[model samples]
Target: MAVDQLAPPPAVPGIPLLGNALPMMGDVQGFLVDTYRRMGPVFQVRALNQSFVIMAGESANRFLIEHGEAVFTSAESFGGLDQQFNMRVHVLRGRPHRHLRKQLAAGVSRDLLAARWDDVMAVTDRTLRSWEGDPALPVVDRFQRLAADQLSIAFTGASSAARFEQLRSAFELVLDATITGKWPRAVLRWPAHRRARAEILAFAREALEQRAQHPTGGPADLLDRALAATDENGQPYPPEVRAGMALQGYFAGINTVAYLYSFMLYALLRHPEVLDRVRAEVDAGGPLTFERLRDMPALHGLVLETLRVYPPAPGSARTVTKAFDFEGFRIEQGRRVIVAASVPHLLPEHFPEPERFDIDRDFAAARKASVYAPFSVGGHTCLGAGMTEVLAVATMATLVRRLTVELPRPERPLRITATPGPNPGKRFKVAVSSRQEQADYST
Candidate 1:
C-alpha cells in the first residue's frame, strides 16, 4: 500500500493551540464515542497539544494489548504516571515489567485472596454498618474510602486506626489530583501533592521496616509478597521499589474497585428486576462465602454487565515503538494509539441493544470475541481482576442482604467526568433503609 494512500485517521479539527484537549478533558468518553460514530473505527484527535490515533472496537484492543510489547510500549504510554506511581510495575516494560507482574500476581493469587475472605467480609460489614445512621450518603465517596480501607488491610495488614486514616487521606488526595488528568507532573511540585506523596512513601517505608523486623514463613499480604518478590536474576527489588509497587496497588484497588462497586449498585437500582434476581440469589446462597459468591452467576453477570456499561477505566493507550499497519492505517513509530475500552461494549455488532443493562448477557461469547474486557486484556491485564470481582460480589451480597438503597434522583442522568474511570461525578447519592424497615413500611 502506498504511504499517501494510507493517510492519517480522520481527525476532528481543533482550536488554534489547544486542539481537542479542552473538549476531551470535559468529557473524554462522549468525545471519543461521538468521534467514532462520525469518523468510523479509526480516527484521530489532538488532546493536550498531542495527536492520538483513536482506535475503537475489539481489533484496537487486540492490537494494543496482544502486540503491545512488540509494536508499542507501556513505558512511553504511561510515562505521565511516573511521578505518581514512581514507574512501578504497571508502567515498566520488557523483562522488568514481566518480573514485577509475576511477583504482584502471586500476591493476589486466588489462594491468597480466598484466604483473605474473612478480612474482606469484616471490612464490608464494618463499612455498611458505618453508613447506618446516615439518611442519604454519597455512595462514591463512602465506597472509595471503604475500598481504600479494605485494600490497606488486605495488602499490608495495616489495622491501626490512625494508620488507616493516614493512608486513606493520602490516597484520597493523590487519587483526586491524578484522576482528573488536569494535574500533570508540574502539579507534583505543589505542596498538597508533595505532602500526599511524602505521606504515602512514609507509610510504605514504615510497613517495609515492620515487615523486615517481623518476617513470616508465608506471605500474609501484598506487602509481604512484594517484600519477598525476586526478579528474573533472583534479586529482590529495593525497598523503595517494593513500596512504590504496593502504593500502585493501593491507587488502583481503591479507585477502580470503588467505582465499579458504585456503578454496579447504580445499574441494579436502575433495573429493579435484575436487582431482585441478584438479591434472591444472595439470600438463597446463605452467607457470602467465597465459594458461594462464585456460584452466584447472576451476581457475576451483573458485575460483568456493569463493567461493560460503565467501565472503571474507559480508555487506555500505547505509544507505537515500530511502524506497523493497523486497520489499513500505516501507524508510524512514535505516535500514540488510544483504545476506548467501552466502545466495543457499545457496538451493536458485538452487543445487541448495547444500551440495555442485561445481567444475562452472553459474556462468554463476548469474551471469546474479544469484546468485553473491562479489566483490560492480554499481557498487561489487571492483576487485581479476581480480587476486585470478589470484593464487588461480597459488597453487593452484604448490602442486598442488609438494606434497600434508593436513589434520591433516579430520573437524573449520570454525568461523566474527565477521570480515567466512569466517575458519575458527585451527584450519585443513595438513601439507605434497613430491609426490615423497608418491608414494614411496605406492609
Candidate 2:
C-alpha cells in the first residue's frame, strides 16, 4: 500500500502547491502547536516541494525519535549547517557521527567540567557585580550576559566580559539566518552572507589553533580538551575539525544556557512570592555554597518546572532512514517526522493543571502519567545537561546570595521572542538591593 494511503489524512488543507507552508513560515512554533490541536498529533504539511509529517504528543514523539530506519538521517537538517557553523563533520548518522560524539565525551567529561567550578563561580561573581547597585536593571539581560561570560570561561577560558556584545551579535546574526525556514540558494550565495560566514569561520579556526599550542591542564576548558582528544585509531583531528568542534561547543553553550537563565529569571520575575520564598530557602539551606546548591529542593523543582514549560528545542525534525512500523502505522523510509516536546509538558495525564507554574509539584509521583522530556531522550539526548545544571545552580545561587532583583513595575507581563532564546524579548527593569530592601519592593 502507498504510504499516503496507509497514513491518516493531513490535519489541514494546503494551497495546492503551497500546502501549509506560508502560514507556518509566518510563525513556526505557533503554527506547529495550533495545527496540532486542529489536526491532532500526527499531520502532514508541504513546503519547498517536500512533504513533512509533523508528529507530536508523548507517545508519537517517543516512537519516532527512539525508532529509526536505515534511510532516516539527520543529514538533511544539517546540510546548511556547514554554511553557518563551518562544521564539516556530519552529525547525520553512521560511524562518523558516533566517533565525533564519543571523542567529544572524552574531551568534556563531567570531571573536567566539575574542576572548572571555580572559574564558573568567578564569572558569576563578576556578572553579579555588574548589577550591584543598579536601581532599574534588567535581570534577563544580566543573566544572558552572565551565562555568555560563564560559557566563555568554561569553553575557551576566554574572558567574555569584554567581548559579550560582539560575540552575542555575531551569534544572533547566525541564528537569525538559520532558524527560519530554509533560505534560498541565492541568499546563501550572496557576497554579504558569504563574507559573514567566512569571518566567523576564520575567527573560530584562529582560536582553536591558538588553544592547541598552549593546553591548559587540570580543569581545562572544552577547547583545550577537544585539542587533546584523539579517535579510537589514535588520530587527532586536524586544525579545521578541532576548530569546528570548538565553534560547535561555543554555539551550543551560548543560546541554550542563556535561554535557560532567561526562563529561570522570568519565573522569578513573574512570581515575586516564589522568588522571595526561594531566597529564604537558599539562605536557610546554607550559604548558597556550591556543594549545597543542588540540595535546594525548591530551586531544583523550579528548574525542572521551567524546563518543562519552556523547552529550548521544543520539537526535532529528522528524516526517516528505513521503513518502520510506528503505533501500527507504516512509516516509510525517507519521510520526515517531528517529535514535539511541548505537547507532553501540557498533557493533562502528565501534568495536573499543566498551565500552573507550581514548583513543588511531584514529578516523581507522576512518572508513568508523564512523558516530559526537556533535554530529550535516547542516545542523542543533550550531552550538556549535567553542566547546564551546575551552571544554573551557580547563577541562581549567586543572584540569591548577593541581592534581590526589584522589578520596577511588576504588574506588566514580559514579551517573548519568536524563536527559542538564550536572549529573549521584553526586558524587566529591576533593581539589585540588599535583602532587607526586598520587602519595600515586594508590595
Candidate 3:
C-alpha cells in the first residue's frame, strides 16, 4: 500500500456548463452503474457547477463504511441546518453525531413501532377502506398517506388526516430545499416553501409546549422521549434541538413506504407466480406479529429483492473533509463525493442473474459480508432504518393478507421521482378489484 503515486479520479465525459447533471438526474441509477462499468469504482462527475467523486463497488464501499468518520464530514453539505434547526442528527459529524444518534435512537427506535403494532394494522385497514369504490388508485399516494398517518400517530399521537396533513403539506418542498438539495437554493424563498418552513417550525413549537405541559408518561411517544433525551454529559438539550431532532423522526419514511409498496405491488402484478408464493406464505403465517414477520423468509426476500432491483436512493452525497486514496485514486480534501451505495446491486459478481428478481438469493450473505449495505453502515447510517423497515414490512404484509388488486399496466415502466425521495411516479397505480373486512390482530 506504500510508495505508489496517487492521482485524481477519472472524470466522466460531459458538455460544458451543465456537465453530467442532466443525464445523471434523468436516470441516476443507470448513469451511476453504467459509468461504474466504464470508469471503475473511483471516478468523477460534474453536476451543474458542483463536482463529485463517485465511490462505488465492493472495495469502495468498505473504505467508506469503515473509514467514513475519518475521511468525511456531512455538516456542511446539509445546508443552513444549524441556523434553522439548532441541532444536527443526520448531517453532523464526529463525536457530536455519535452522541446525538445514541440519544435519538430511543425516540425513533424499532421497538416503538412494535409497541404500536395495532395502530399500524388499523391504519392500513382505514386506508384500504378508503379505496373501496375507486377503480384505479395510485399506489404511491395511497401508500404515502398510509405512512404519514402511521408515522404521525407514532410520533405525535394523532392519525386523522386533519392532524397529520399539517406535518405533510408542502413537506417535500421544504425537505428538498433544506435537506436533499434537489431544489435550487433560491427555491427556499418561494412563497409556498417559505410558508411550509414557517408551519413546520410553528408546529414543532406548539407540540413541544403541549407535550411539556401534559408529560403523561404511559408509553413514551417520540416527542416525550426526545424531550427527556440528554447529551453525553447528561446535559439536557435546548428546546430547539429537542424539537428539531424529534420532528425528523416524525416524517422519516413516507417516501420509502410509497416507493417500496408501489414496486413490490407492481412486481407482484407482473409475476403472478411470485404473488401466489407470497400470498401462500402470508396465509400460512396466521398472525402478523413483529416476531412472526421476521421469520417469514418469503416476505423478507420479496422486500429485499425489491430493494435490490429498485432502491429508493441510488447513492448519497457527502463532502470530504480529509483526503483519501481509493483504487489508486486520490480523493482530495474539500471535494464533494457521491457514495453510490446501491451500485453493487447491478454487479453480477455480487448478485447472480442481477436483473432477475429471485427473492431466495442469499442477499443475507452479501449484507453480512458488508458488500450490500442499502441503508449504509457506520457513524452516518440512517437513524430510522429500523423504523422504516418495520413500517414497510408490516404495511406490505397487511396489504397482501387483506385484499386482492390488479395493476392496470403491469408492463408500465417504474419511473422514479427523486425529489423529497424516490417514489414511483403517479402513473404507477393499481385497480382495486375486491376487498376484505377490517382485521383484529390482537387476541
Q: Give the TM-score of candidate 2.
A: 0.83
Candidate 2 regions exceeding 4 Å error are 1-4, 13-37, 45-51, 69-71, 88-90, 132-141, 161-163, 182-193, 232-234, 285-287, 322-336, 364-370, 420-423, 426-443
Alpha carbon deviation, residue 200, candidate 2 (Å)? 3.2
C-alpha RMSD (angstroms) for model 2: 4.3
How close is each model in CA RMSD to the real structure? 3.4, 4.3, 2.7
Task: Give Cα distance to truth, residue 12, candidate 2, Å.
Answer: 3.2
On a 0 to 1 TM-score scale, where does candidate 3 land against the true structure? 0.91
With a 3 Å backbone cut-off (N, CA, C), the pairs that clash in candidate 1 are none
Scored against the true structure, residue 109 in model 3 reaches a CA lDDT of 70
Best by lDDT: 3
Q: Scored by Cα lDDT, where does model 2 land?
A: 0.65
Write down the lDDT that model 3 would get: 0.74
TM-score of each: 0.90, 0.83, 0.91
Of candidates 3 and 2, the better by lDDT: 3
Model 1, 1-443: lDDT tens digits are 96446777777888887888877765576677677777777888876646788878778877766777888776665554555546377577788788888888777666776776687678778778677656679988888778877776676665434554555555554444443344554655778767767776887677778788987555566777777777778987776788776675565577788888888888888899999898878766456777776698888888888888877666776777888777887777888877776688777888899878888887888887677878767677778888888788878878887787898877888766665456766778888876773222100
Per residue, candidate 3 scores C-alpha lDDT tens digits across 170-231 of: 55655666545567778767787667667777777788788889886657877887788787
- Pairs that collide in candidate 3 are none
User: Which regions of candidate 3 deviate over 4 angstroms?
Assistant: 1-5, 80-87, 163-166, 178-181, 435-443
**Full ranking by TM-score:** 3, 1, 2
